[model samples]
Target: MAKEYEFTQIIKDHEGVIFKITTIYTNNHEDQKDLYQEIVYQLWKSFDNFRGDSKISTWMYRVGLNTAITRLKKEKRKGNQIGIDQVIMKQTDQYDTEFEERLKILYAHIHGLNELEKGLMLLLLEGKKYEEIASITGLSPSNVGTRISRIKQKLKTQIVKK
Candidate 1:
């Protein structure tokens, strides 16, 4: 359908969201790449049901995050050891190698967070509305607001230390 084509185009234009979500959920490079592919595949599968009820990006966050969560669950069950270099980092322009290393350290800390905190921060960084984050993450609006506030303070402290 034309809608599906447009949706694919939109995803291609804004690929960073997928990358960010993958980075947020995965501990290592291989898992990141797998999660990124799973997000893309889920998005494509869900395209026909989009219905334009929400912003495409909001819908995408929902699908991608859900897919990542499910994949994490599956990995836990299978005892999989996702390799670091399995990720194809061949296209990281502008972000230098040092920045990537620092980002990996940051991501490692982020991966230590509980699932709710991780989801909250990921959507917050993606600029989703509080209501939208609640819709996707199943938190009350006020709870989402409080959590985001705390997360910001925590991130500030961490950044100050570094």
Candidate 2:
């Protein structure tokens, strides 16, 4: 269908945003890919709900993040580990450098965070301000700021020890 083609094109145009969310939420290659597919599926399913109330990317992020979070929960309930550590290791093996090592550690720390925190960090990494993150996450602006500060401090401490 022409509509489907246009919709897929729109999603492809914003694929990186979805990939970022998927990467943050899932560590294992399998889970990351599964979650990526799930996000795309959800976007397609919810396309009709788009009412131009917010930016298209904003809506996509909300839906994709929510779907990824929910899928993580479901997988956990099924006793799956998501294998993010393995994925990181494989990635690190491709480049044996201090930066990749540090990045792997940071990724591990991020993987340990809750779903909401992961979403917030992804948005922050994308250069969103606290207010924008709060809008998408339903947290108070101050709370988002506080959480980012704390996360940064935690990462700083970890990086110092390495």
Candidate 3:
């Protein structure tokens, strides 16, 4: 019972992280919800083995990302699905039209990146420090930095060409 409570609280505290990951990895609402549930399920399955060696958020990212990547691979093996034409933007009135358009463009470019680059860019966009990203991704901090630099330049070039 106590274990369930603890796990529930952890999920509540970090639900946004899960949502962001799901949104980044999935193209539509149904897929996003499926991925979100899968991530939570995987997290719960491994809850007993969590040793507190890392921040819970880091652990969650590691598990969530690995699960998402694995699912994507499985999906590819099952053959291609039709791509959705509409981008999934959060429905918020706070942003002006121009900012929203730019955000859409940004996400489109992000979706074009390779899987590893997509994960790295997602972590960077979440404002995680290099060391945290490195820990979550199993990459050296310097490699994270180098990859991010390349990703930024790639995004810049792509956006410019658009």
Q: Estimate each model's TM-score.
A: 0.74, 0.78, 0.84
| Candidate topping lDDT | 3
Candidate 3 residues lying further than 4 Å off, grouped into runs, are 72-99
Give the winner by TM-score. 3
Residue-wise C-alpha lDDT for candidate 2, range 1-162, written one tens digit per residue = 987998979886997887778768775776776787778889999888887788887888889888987773445434454443532335555876988887777788888676667888888988987788888888999999999998888778766876
The lDDT of model 2 is: 0.78
Clashing residue pairs in candidate 1 are none
Q: What is the TM-score of candidate 1? A: 0.74
Once model 3 is optimally superposed onto the true structure by TM-score, how far is the C-alpha of residue 144 displaced, in angstroms?
A: 1.0
For model 1, the stretches where C-alpha displacement exceeds 4 angstroms are 1-4, 72-93, 96-98, 152-162
Clashing pairs in 2: 27-84, 28-83, 28-84
- lDDT of every predicted structure (CA atoms): 0.77, 0.78, 0.84
Each candidate: RMSD = 4.6, 4.8, 5.2
Ranking by TM-score: 3, 2, 1
Residue lDDT tens for model 3, 45-130: 99999989889998999999998899843343333333321323355555888888887777798898998999999999999999
Clashing pairs for predicted structure model 3, backbone only: none
Error of 3 at 61 (Å): 0.6
Residue 155 CA displacement from its true place in model 3, Å = 0.5
